[model samples]
Target: MRRNTGVFIAFAIVFCWFALLTFLLQFPTVFTEPWPYILLLLQTHLYTGLFITAHDAMHGVAAPGNIKLNTVIGFVCALLFAFNWYPRLLPKHHQHHHFVATEKDPDYHGGNFWAWYLSFLKQYITWPQMLAMALTFNILTYFFPLENVVLYWMLPAVLATFQLFYFGTYQPHKGEHNAENKHRSTTLKRNHVWAFISCYFFGYHYEHHDKPFLPWWKLYQEKDRSFK
Candidate 1:
């Protein structure tokens, strides 16, 4: 229970920070020459956090025992990404865990990185969602500078898709796996800081597959043993 509360508070803080940054970036004066690009990089990580949070909820680790709250949090975080379908993702993710790297896994892509990413996007992105995101962007652009909207909100979300796919799915599941091992995943051997910055230690895919309940933030602590 304490862990769940801590996870909730941490997520709230990071998400609120992202929102505040987005709101502030709308003022043209705030984004001077390089600052805008710098913030975009930071925003990308924060946006990735939103997806990671929703992913945690799918595993029942974000707000344990409270299905309604978990669903609400997951739904909202996913919508913020403009490409998520959390309810649908829950079952699909479970299937990935059950039949990882096999044809039965929704995330399996035969180790083709680009193909895997596009296939991942195809699962959730639909015309209705695209139209809704476009409408929302158009409406928000009326109040915020179009550049600000694109840089801070839109680009970060897009970059985060790659970030999540690369760190969470591709690198881990790529290459050959021994058929004897049920969990077909590999771990990165980089130091903890790089691992955290890269994908919040998701490169420690073996530990994640072994213990999916530990929220992503905590994955960093178990890095040394997990990595090759």
Candidate 2:
């Protein structure tokens, strides 16, 4: 099947799943006790899926010759989590793709297990200039009152989740010579399954790295092709 076709199939499945979950959340009996927490978690998970889809769009992996469409999709997806719609960040993310596994890459893996663990914190907190970012997030949340959650709280939380997800997947594939490489290689069996089910198969990072232009659904096909 074509990459785009696969992506559409994957997207349809994910959308349906989220829709079902949302429907279930509306029933007090279905969600049972602690409905608020359940709803929040479900919403956050759905938002993460949207965020990954937006990332794909930003990379032009979701659409062709339609930059505006990609921008609009990405911006709308970010808004679901109360994030800023900064088009400039797309270029920086693209740059990471170019350098993939190297230290010279700002997004490199950068150390051993412990080091990488610590680095994840730094990536999510420090590099973004946490205090200033927190203030900005707060300001944004204060202005927007979607989902009853303060905009500031939601923005930072969602952005932090994205950062952690990115680092967890990217770091494993980074080069040994890279500043963040504490190990020669990393495994993704656990993460991949969870990401596939939770983050809309975005944990298939190795496959994505191999065929950057291929849509998400065809990512697995590309992985299979390498063995063939």
Candidate 2 C-alpha lDDT tens digits along 128-192: 34455567546544654433333224533554475445544544565444445333334344343
* lDDT of candidate 2 at residue 78, scale 0 to 100: 51
Mind giving the per-residue lDDT tens digits that candidate 1 earns over 1-228? 674783665468466756766665565745547777777888888888788888888887777777777788778777777757777778999999999988998888884677889998887678878898899889878988888778877888789888988888988898899976568998888578888788877888888998888888777766644443
- The C-alpha TM-scores of every prediction are 0.89, 0.60
Candidate 1 lDDT trough over 10 residues, lowest sum: 23-32
Clashes of 1: 0
Candidate 2 local Cα displacement, residue 186, angstroms: 5.6
